[model samples]
Target chain A: MSNNEHVKVPANLMRRFADDPEQADLEVFGRRSDGDRRGFLRGAGLATMGAMLGAAIPFNRNMPAGFVPEALAQKAMTVDGKDGLTVLNDRPVNAETPPHLLDDDVTPTARHFIRNNGIPPENTSADGWSLTVDGLVNNPMTLSIADLKSKFEVVTERLVVECGGNGRAFFDPPAKGNQWSLGAVACSEWTGVRYSDVLKAAGVKDNVIYTAHVGADSHLSGKDGKLAISRGVPIEKAMNPHNLIAFAMNGKELHPMNGAPLRLVVPGWPGSCSQKWLKRVWLRDVVHDGPKMTGKAYRVPKYPVEAGQKVPKGDFEIIQAMPVKSLITTPQTGIKMSGRSMKVGGHAWAGDGKVSKVDVSIDFGATWQSADLSDPANPYAWQRFGAGITFPMAGYYEVWARATDSEGRSQPFGIAWNPKGYLNNSMHRISVYVS
Target chain B: MMQRLLPHLFVLVLLGAILLAPGRPAWADEDELGGIPRAPGAEETYYLCSACHSFRLVAQQGLSYESWKETLVWMIEEQDMSTPEPEERELITKYLAKFYGRDRLARKLAKQQ
Candidate 1:
């Protein structure tokens, strides 16, 4: 896993589908023949190819230029890694931790999914890091990591930080951006100061409508280095007791990739609201129209749009609480079952409130069996569930998990497609083969 | 390592296909600029789109001609991406539609699903 090690790309990108990575004929793929490739390449000139290759000539991060980080690369090479997660992009590195890898009560930092809008800051040292609280406040203040630890109560809570577009790949037409499967979600124990306590210290004004969270990471657009992804939530959500200005994860300092030094942990909302490498929290009068807040970045249809229907500009609604979602982690997709029965378990969470119940459908939603839902450690922590099922025959089967929130909201069978492909909390399905 | 080599190898395989079998382009946009497949105006499209992020990000999405045009307008007004010349826009738009169009995207999605 060292930088100097020679990394070999596995010929196969899929896990359960292709059991033999070594024998996967990546060149021919499954259906595309040699002639099809030749015609496509003939249309695509080598001059262009040569030019792109030239840009990558000086791969000097002490590693390959276009390659993923050493850790991610190593993880993807192993059989377990292939089944555990998929890397969507490498530069601003985006990767999803397979639902099976996230079966644990607390998601390990290494297994946490990464969703970065900008390049991570190189200076991760906490020695000089400070967080400034300004805008719509009576008294603005700046606090360091040590000050945050000593000044305010530090509490630990297990919660899920899910991307808004977690299950986008399953969209019929397929949405834009990372065609993420069911891996863009994970739960972790975060230790930090209560954001409400910080807001009290800052002496927020009554007129404040929103609180903007800013980070130090620079935009990858190459336009301006100072351009960072600064987004915010409503004042009510910002002042919630559960939100945190986290400095540590699982009793350790935050990983650089996970926004080291400090980050906003706004549970139940889109992960983008929890800005990593957090530098500022600016209270605003109107909705904070920062980088991602404008346009249709995080907004979906106000009302459901039929699949493939175009949404008008004003018909969009900003995403707030995520929908009810659950994933079956144990027995993973593609598990070869030697016995007729197997134990299945996973986690579920509701954005607006706590999970009320979870149902497992082994017969592809024909019938459902209620899984025992565990009491949450905290209000926002994901609730764990387990169920045992016996197969009638040896064949292929899909285990679908559906979660319902306290508000009686259950996950939809299929997601309504939007341009940005946000908030896809459809029933999670895992395919298994019984021998 | 293998993660990095995987995309390069896939692109190379697609490149290799140029000889006997010229099939549909494989999913090639998941890395930095280097991973973009070669096509008409491929260089122009990659450089222009990549000024903001990797071409792979752009290549991942499937947008219609009108939606792509709207995306350009939004980029200019919101994301600070520069607008290309009229002629340049036509080329880039055509290139985008050809490589990352709805048809191409359907193939990629169908294969993965």
Candidate 2:
């Protein structure tokens, strides 16, 4: 039995290199020029082999000014190897947890996807870190972690926070940003105070319609130089019962990678709204036009686009609640099996709605069977689904999971081709061999 | 057939070009390149973009010349990235469009299909 295994390189790199010489040129090895050569030798068969041997050389150990360090790339690959997380970028640390590894109802903090717009500040401690609530409020106050725990009723709830472009690789004509597979999402129990309670203490002004969130993570260049991605959610979303200013994840102090000290947990919205290492929450009269809010950052086309079509002018809308999506974490694709029957299970989530039903297909969507879905622990948490499958006679099979929300919206077979590849809730398929 | 062999043959031609080029170093490493195109003025282009984020992030997106121009404009306007003067912007645009542009991506995609 043969199964396509996930290689560490970008999804298209190996295939593209195999297809054309020009494709090889576009890859890491092909970008070399004579004048700027390093101290690593390679054979001519390197391109044909499609294995990046030169990538092993650690020449950027002490990268010069204005160059990204090689250590971050190495760490990105090694940091969460158990989850089979795929690295998309290193500086500012962006990686995706493979769908197969995200099988549990509550994702382990280590398995959660790491999507950072700026580098985590060195030596961030609860000592110096405090959250400031200001703008359109009668009382502006900066509160420490102790203030948050003492002043407000601390609550713990499970929630799903996913990148808007979770399954971007499925997009045809392929979009910009990280080419994330179905691993850019996770469900976790977040512990903190309700954001509304904090705002209430500050006395919300009537005209306030949005909350601009800012974090301590600074740019690799400099803070005074460029803004490190200040984004916001509408006042309505911020006022949701589940929205939190979380200080802990999975019952432990938040992992520095997950967001230490405090992070906003905006359940059922794009993870960007949940600013990690959060420090400031500014109430605003209008939508926050921060770095990512403008010019097609988290925005997508208002209507379905034909593949390869340029985005129409003024049709781009800011993505709010993500669409219904599911992933099969068990029986990871390409795992060879000897059993007649196997326990198949995974996790599913719907933004601003419940995952009403989840269906599993063993014959590549030819036939479908209902997977028993566990109830969501909270209104915003992802639900776990499981089903027993007995293969009559199987050489190779791909298990596909599709989810439908209570609103009757279901995951599409193919993602609508948006330019930025936002909201890719296509069916999550995993292949395995049953012998 | 030559169709099958053409890509392999093209690699050989590229190798020969590297071997024959002036001031060519004896070796090259992937870490040094970081996927940046080693075309003329790439250093200027790399540092210019690195002022905001990693060059690898920019290199990953294969865009059309127009899209690349628009990206620079987007960086300058939306991202608060410092704007380069007219002549410098032209040079950087040429370098980006030449290597990371749509034609190269389309060529690769056509072959893959």
Candidate 3:
């Protein structure tokens, strides 16, 4: 039969069958005309059909005559293991929390954004998982979860982990990676032993200058032994007491998408530095040349480049502490209010410094008023800020948030253009209509 | 012109289906080319690029032809992608630049503003 002659199956029904064949109504397949079904089966056998679907049909025998499987149903764009996230890409599974859903001070694990560069490792259970600390170490060691717990002092702290490419969607030329908006960040409570403790236990050599982190996630190309991503930080950053080899989030075992059983939580820097599904920590004498470390994977232009400027490879530098940024979590955009007065609140953080202030403006940056900023629960935790703003009159207004770091650096009015579109900490604005 | 390319595109799609058959169940619907409008090289572009990452990643960008060519070169050199024939490379670049070209940048900026 010609391709056009094949009966079209609805994508949702195909997804239902793929997700749970047992729950599927086999009679639906039987409803098709016998002649067409026979022709389809004869033209492309059950094996070929299954191959086209990318898996063997578990209940192929039960599939009655005249059944035609549609093109492999695209996995439903909605994420299976997340809550209320806007999926950008489903293949390597990158989703972001909408600003409305990110209202909680301590972000719920389910609401946290999922950013995966590679397919998550299948065997995420703690039973057989082990972490090896080697390279430039006087005493290389491998430790299990139990051993890690018994040997080191376990600590829990609320820390913010933001993607390096957060707000990339605002880039004018459009970045090459996931077009993350404002929600690729979350401040969650993580429990684990400090990374410094682990490295010290391994007896770091004096010559070690950088750390290379490896994870179990497989590369997208299905290449054997090829890592999905391997990024690291400088030795000084790795040894920061606030950094942790986190195994738990929000008082529970880490979610598989967030790196179950074991992961790194190097807060304040790019989230890529905190490798998920962590397998090894290798100390290196020189900069770690991992899959994403070299070239322009997570780096930005050393100096600011114009929107369409061509940047040479040597001019790019790795992003360290994220620039000062803030997000308005409550009173989501497009909200309509009857009164002139409104309460606005959100969270703010600086990469290596504390958020000194977060100012709110309703007149499109014409004037600014300081919001009451709260102290962080712990180092690296985001500070909550809120303010009561009284509008002059009923009209459409935009609330813009600009956060300043302890060093007095503040968010810019526009995105600082770069080739890779990393580190876009422009001031965030939301729309509100008042009558 | 499209009619001539259809047969070759079908063969490539069939090969992709067969090559991808033995692995894990398809996580993504292979037939659903997100945001990639039908064009001369749509099938070939979908089959080749979707072999690794989502076509949505490609659809998100709006770059000049030179930038798109540089991306393809980067893929071959750094991303372990096999280099395509010169003609095939040109075809893919032309298709990408035509659909996801500099105009997309203007549309995105307007939408955001």
Candidate 4:
């Protein structure tokens, strides 16, 4: 039999067989010999089967003897709290939004992508939760959610938070971590106190050069003391007033998966720098050498390396501001175009810079037409861009969107090869089936 | 008739108790091999790797033999995973490289170019 065609036995029958092998006929398991059936049961009992299922079989008791659960048969998996997301990994729960779902100006909370390195904290209650600012600070402070709202100035700003490995899946060799497509980015209205204000309140010492952020998320290894990931930003970036110690997303409380109660919104940088389930911020005299800080955790090669080439750790530098990138959110990919002229639009963003220009191509980058681009609502918020494209003749056409940053840098047609793929700002393209 | 009905009633009660259970069922704690393809060294690889993370994490990568070895070493040195025995390591690496090689579709596209 082919590897794909595995004979699936229901949980109840498997249990009965485990209890009495002689009474259970081997014919039910399809062409399996008596010895084979015994070995299979011994190796993979009901519990092993449960783990293989990825989730608990809630109605296993009512299932018929030969019934296969829909969960086991279905290939596509959806996350519980997420909508229209492509689940990359269910264990650590890394998911990305489909580009079409990201059409909203301010990405809805459900539509926001989830990029988790470790399991989120089980208990995320804000009532007694507190954020600690310590290490190289003259006045170390621990402020509760209530204290944070009352003591500091509360402000809301729309900001873009994108994963460093947003387009890692497009890499030729493929990246090591989550293979996020284009959807690991969102511009959400965040409500919180300015990070600089909180830092000043804590009295950052002169020796501080970097900030190390810690979260309540548990390590994937199930190890007690091990941290899943702890990344930080340079003190200068942390000191930016645009950075927020965010407590809410949009107008509502932050989603649990998006870091309920508290998180840091360090915009224009990798979302990893924006620590979620934030517990503490440690100011370091030297660069913060925390978990995922040193080596190539978020760092790319200091210089470009050939694809599949090995590079030493010292030759790597940490990624700061993300490159210019844009996405065509309208007329979702593979849509049937009803008319010759279509209003094409999307969002463009540049880390620590403004999107100066956006261009759309109907003939696959051979030629391009400029798209009308809107200025960002805030310094780190993504800018909206729109254009009306008239297809000369409707054959199968692809709409490609590319944005140029204030520095005149545009999205690359080819990927800049790195061992651990990060910062891939390739031009976004969508398919249009025009009759 | 009464005796037959008694057995059926007992089964109903047992099913009700199981269905009404508050948390995950008892079978949830079993060793999950993540339904990885059954191969020569698959069982060993699953046991060794799944101790730290799900086997799906291991299965996700399509790396060369050397890269897989490097990953194993990295796991031991950096990620706090205990070093496996030499034979076990070799078996696991070879199994991974064979099943999930660098011949992924994306890599193929690069090679064609």
Candidate 5:
């Protein structure tokens, strides 16, 4: 912001990256114009939440700075691994059930949530790095690590990225996609070069409405040896200033799992649009539809389906912004509360839209009251909401939260179950206790 | 946007198809409770087991036999591979080399169609 506080990296800059026939020079993040090379990254806003309290985050051991400890801010606690109540993945514990519900305005990186496609990538660095900007462009170029830094103007924004499969495990009937438990989402202050800069460099053409992006890590390949990553966004969404080509988080370098060197930051969208380990950006007018693109994943039934019905391919559309929803962080379901004033907090988010109002219900939707919403500062950022309720009487309080967006879109209570547990906007609920 | 995708919905065929896969190419054998092990030894176990590492889209991989073999070696060195019995290893090798082997596409497709 200049002395006038004018919007610097204005929101519409993303439009410049669209399929414009006139291509501009693309710049990567981290270059200081005066011969210093920077990489793509989001700066300011929320501090980067890398690192954790108890365990070590391998692969991304060496990180740059500006990463606030919100991601890593947590009272360290490691459970006894012998307990069968654990799901083992990357490390002994990829995720855990917090002893108490969380109410912190910011989700600590350690307690954020754990969802992995495969083991997190290690040993990735800014050196030997290059971002490939191609497809539907006049100039397709492979930008060297330094090329991205030295050339582009850098800006920062804070937004939340939630996996489409978030909250999938709670679905009534199991679905095909990863049945991710609640913690698959995280918010970050992404700092990076503008997608517009890169798009300008690549020189977008007319008649393009969408762009497809692929990641670096390829697991078991599909037929023809296609890599395992997949994702895309409408030209409109990508052009939103909130949409970022992030190179840094919380002021430091990126971890491999989070897409070091570069990643997309599509505000109000699911993790799908923010492809990690980002390698290539294809600026095509055609919609993406490989197995990773349009096939078999990140889709929801286009309309409501009967409960317990299996989702067929045709009944759904790609999941974009999350529904108006909130999570009760404290007194997590099954928590015991004393006969006193208890502070309750959780997170509320609306996809591509602003979270306008949040209401909390203690008695399983019997009644509702407004909850305090956090000033995310940025429209695309997650709002930390809270409420204080006295448990005068308590047996089992089915606590839940509902949110409404600036567009007047509120979360529905228990959306119909689909085959692949896609966007579940059901009112966020957690059961608690009063002794 | 109320777009009628019923024309594009593959439910009619797929709903009927999912239930009838018992006799298909990927059918599980009932006689052997453990069925036939796909690969044998530490290296083979990684190939057979890690192929379906996790159900996550990022985790699902349909690896070829050759790559699977290479992956097993890497896993053993990078990721720890537990050792197994010799005879069990032989059974796994026979089954995997025959079923998941590079040339098994012909037999698998014939069974499916």
Candidate 6:
């Protein structure tokens, strides 16, 4: 660990979805950085960190504008500022979380799962926002939020995010926009600045390939902001190593409907390009895809339909990574699960692949078993699982699980209905209780 | 929030056209279209259903007069909601009485019509 060392990714990971806060650009992707510091990609493996030389905009170096920093200015109008329960700001970015779950490792930030395309800023701040970075780098900075936590080196992960319209409004012809259930998806613990430590502090310039991200929310299209809210990743998920730029989520800070200060967790991928209030990343050169990537919307119809069908407008492709899933956290849907030995739990993931096996079922997919799971120390996280089953006779039973992964995919019986209801992975059901 | 998600998206496009057009009384209307406000309740159903389309989709509906006419024909062919004009579905079923008149014959004809 010599030649100016650097590895530190530390502290506050995720505990039952974590303590919540840090959004609205999580202080513009940063804040709270002290001394021994050193995080610019933990010793510049992507080649001597210093992103093109911070791309050069330290507060208008000859006027480049849009940077925001006066203590993130304003936005906090309600996620609980008052009579909250506006079902997390009343429907659309996927008509608020409803995709089979009795519990999946804490998603209750008011059913945690939104999906936003435009309208989310509410009240507002991070002062006005700006990040820039630019193509093939070479020090192209724009910083602010106190120059990205006083110039950089801060990373945290826990991850989860998910909203290629989280279940895309259960697709079909229905695939026009945000009716998202399964709560658009959420998991927390973001903390920022390691988009390869801002692409090695900004110095990559060579033939590029692809890397966009954008987002400030309003280009306002409506049909729930009509798709293409900006996306393009593929500079190896944009310089990978676990793409962060996050700012904060379960450590208290992110709140503009969860994309404040800055966002782009990337972990398992699919939350509308994971952009959210995030400002810019740029770097394209030749493989862009920009109508929010690949043009117009998160396409799908290369084939497979029959649950609802309306996927027609040019057929699909943009949406990605979201498959083997699970839910059932408590019994609040009209309530009734506290009787049959019934324990059941939730949270599973797979698209980028790895889950392995989940199973469950009680009736609506017929008999199966497996359950117990909980693994995830982070293989992209989200595992939990559980089981108990015991009502044998009493009454209501439905319960379900499914999972499978390691790339065999499983959890199907339902994702093909593509109006916009993207990648379902089915088998969730939920019904319990029996005295 | 975008007007509380436009009435659960006109109740999921009137629950996907009552699961793809099955019956058809979908709130029958040879345009006898009674007084219009159909059943309104609070603040005159948010001051007459946001003058049409933003009582956040008439306060996120709970419709089923056959998915409220395919959710009012997907809000009059994609949210324009015209046609039964003259009293405008009797002022949106009398401002959909306390939330889409939860039928009991729309709360006894929303108080004797």
Best by TM-score: 4
Give lDDT for model 5.
Answer: 0.55
Worst 10 residues of 5 chain A by lDDT: A44-53
lDDT digits (tens) for residues A235-286 of candidate 6? 7666667667776666656766667777777767676667777777788687
Estimate TM-scores for all models: 0.81, 0.79, 0.81, 0.81, 0.63, 0.30
True contacts kept of 5: 0.02
lDDT of 1 by residue, A1-435 (tens): 333223223212333114332222222122211242321123322222222232221222132112223333344532121234556665566778877788899998888888888878899889999999999899999999999999999999997899998887676665667767788888889999999999999999999999888899987765665555789999999889999999999889887878898999999999888899999899999999888887777899888777878788788878999989998889778788778998899999988599999999889899999999998889889999999988999999988899999899998887767878888888888788998
Clashes of 2: 0
lDDT of 3 by residue, A138-246 (tens): 9999999988999999999999999999888787777777888889999999999999999999999999999999999998888899887999999999999999999
Can you write out model 5's per-residue Cα lDDT over A1-435, one digit (the tens) per residue?
112111112111222223220121021111111122121122211111110111122222233222212222122223332121213242212443342423444433333344444434454687877778888889989986568778887887767777776656555534434445565666667788777777877888887778888776544422234455567887777777667788887677765556677777786777767777777888877877743566346777787787556557566687767776677666656667677567777777888777888888887788888889877768777888888876657577777788888899888876557756677777767777677
Residue A209 lDDT in candidate 5: 77
Write the candidate numbers in order of decreasing lDDT.
3, 4, 2, 1, 5, 6
Best by lDDT: 3
lDDT of 2 at A206: 95
lDDT values, one for every candidate: 0.73, 0.74, 0.80, 0.78, 0.55, 0.52
Candidate 2's residue-wise lDDT over A318-339, tens digit each?
9999899988888677778898
Q: C-alpha displacement of A88 in model 1, angstroms?
A: 0.6
Please give the lDDT score at residue B79 for candidate 1. 67
> Candidate 2: where is the Cα deviation over 4 Å?
A1-76, A80-83, A220-225, A338-340, B1-31, B35-44, B80-113
Worst lDDT run of 10 residues, candidate 1 chain A, spans A24-33
User: Which tens-of-lDDT digit does each residue in B1-113 have in candidate 2?
Assistant: 99999978877776664454333233333333444545775867877887667665665566766777888897776566788988889888888878766555533443221
Task: Give the better candidate number (4 or 6) by DockQ.
Answer: 4
Candidate 6 docking class: incorrect
DockQ of each: 0.18, 0.14, 0.13, 0.19, 0.02, 0.01
Output the number of the DockQ-best candidate.
4
Which regions of candidate 1 are displaced past 4 Å? A1-84, B1-35, B105-113
Regions of candidate 3 where Cα sits further than 4 Å from its true position: A1-76, B1-35, B105-113
